[model samples]
Target: LSLSGFINIYLQKTFVSKQLSNLLINGVQPPPLPSKKKVVVDFSSPNIAKEMHVGHLRSTIIGDSMCRLFEFLGYEVLRLNHVGDWGTQFGMLIAHLQDMFPDYLTVSPPIGDLQAFYKFQKIYDCLDIKLIERGESYYQDQMVEVVKEFEKKGLVELDEGRKVVFPPGQPIPLTVVKSDGGYTYDTSDLAAIRQRIFEEKADIIIYVTDSGQSTHFQVVFAAVQLIGWYDPKVIRVEHAGFGVVLGEDK
Candidate 1:
């Protein structure tokens, strides 16, 4: 046979080898990691007292799948439900709740419809208020403190009465604090990351969200890395972004 013919025969044999079939059928599971590495799969972080929308469903499904995969792979998977239990929105919610029920602290109010109650306590609020939550109150001060410390290091700066970080080569600067001096999503995320790394000892941290927030996560990740909180060598951080789940045009 010609050289080319012989090469073709060899390739065919290699592809259809009995060993290959066995490997494929048996599924060669990779050996476990050297040590039980701590991994935090931060996903499905829906805020408390809010209706879970399609977005929340997406995160929950995908995050659960990842957790299963990691667990099977022999890593110490921490299925972190990074619940959105913090921020200015919660402040508004509490204040409104207090106005509605002054004894809310001492007495547990009967909530008939969460969505309705959350949407319009007395007057109709924003349209998006239907899925509001009240979870991150404790992190309020912590987030502010974290941003202020970053500001002292020259990483975060005040643009217009708001503390922010304009990352190198990035267009939109991450707003840690707003003009009202209220802590934003950026500040809470930083505080969470700091705690995850230092306290939780998360060697590998992953955030699963839709592609829309890609820039937001990127900016926050960069900010933390710049401030020396995240060192690539010691720990790994990634944003597992997915595309949108659009409805078909009927």
Candidate 2:
């Protein structure tokens, strides 16, 4: 087609899209998904109490765009902010919280005020971001089961006293559980994937992190695949990784 003709057609399509964008549904019928689709987007998981830097900003912007696009397409999107609220660091945080709020140690201590404080620490009063804060600690029990099942199935092998799974083609073998029987990030990540698949019924689970975690997610997704938790034909798991930030001077 000629350049002018093509431009005219594209303009018409764009105009139509803008017109129908607000009409999510004519009546009770809703927009269509490509297929049986539930998406779980894991993103912007800054460690608790840590400062938000360039890395966090990049992740948030990229992930939010992805979520917005998927939601607009009528996909059931689970926006999972995989916050670092688990493991020993949390023990330290809890100790500090207890020290500051001594009543935390007391029997039938006050929690209402603290809870309210957490809930209201927002950017603005009138703005609604619809943020639901759920800690990774909430999934501790589920992670235990996930690791135990791997142990039971012999899917993991011990490497120098640490339970690990060396998925083929990956240099970094995933640590299923520590020598002390504590779960590692590998165990927790796989467990979260299982939760998204079975409980949330997510057909596509995406991890949006820096390229550093690309291999990590590969192994986690592979572990789930090996465990028969998901099939590539039926479900999809992806790692949408981004590059590192460097000073312009460098």
Candidate 3:
């Protein structure tokens, strides 16, 4: 045989040997699977009044695929679209809309033009100073009442200007109220988490948000622990970490 022919034959023999070894191992029993149970797979829930951009599209695609896979594997899947429906941003969106049409934000569509609404809110926030002031005031008043009640009960406190929630060192004091007395992210998140657990009865609450927000999620999960919502062993809260997409390099 030619030199090249001999080399090819030798390579093929080595490949076959490796394949046989792999096949023999494959005959062993696979590891036991986890106990069958229902699962809640949350993903792609864009803020209610925000645009469904390319990133959101990717979330929907991946989340739905996961839902399907879990369903096929005999897990009862509950799909959650935890929309960002409430916040300071909404105050502007609602206020600017109230100024423009006087009746814009009345209709809370189940799933409607969120991206456009967010865009409109941004435009109003930038162009109109008076409207921004009004928006900030609106959200502030709403937060004060809740924080005062919590403070009176001694469930929360102000530390270093911001509302710090000291829940036995599991997590930092939650900032339900900001330094300016505005409702921070924690309040809305806690309300949403409570609703999901009690109303939706979510077995697994997976937050499919940006990885940079992992610390925020850890704090939220710790707060959940403080609130005594679920047994840490049974109920699962996870931040499904993922990276941002970048342009392909040549």
lDDT of 3 by residue, 1-250 (tens): 6555344434578799887888798754434448665666666665555554566555555666777766676676777655555666678777866676654468644434445455533532453311111222233444455456456667786677788776666545678877876566776566656655776677777767667678788887876677576777978877786777655871
Q: Is candidate 1 or candidate 2 better by lDDT?
A: 2
Q: Number of the top candidate by lDDT?
A: 2
lDDT computed for candidate 2: 0.75
Clashes of each: 3, 0, 5
What clash pairs does model 3 have?
47-84, 48-84, 51-115, 165-173, 165-174
> lDDT by residue for model 2 over 1-250, one digit each (tens)?
6555343434587788866875655533446755747888887677765545556767766877888778777887878777767787878878878777777655665657555534332521333223345567767899888878887878878788898987677677888778887878887787778778888998888888999888788888777878788999988889999998878985
Give per-model TM-scores.
0.74, 0.74, 0.60
**Worst 10 contiguous positions by lDDT, candidate 1:** 123-132
Tens digits of per-residue lDDT for model 1 on 40-59? Answer: 88776666646655556677
Lowest lDDT 10-residue stretch of candidate 3: 128-137
lDDT, residue 189, candidate 2: 85
RMSD of 2: 5.7
The total of clashing pairs for model 1 equals 3
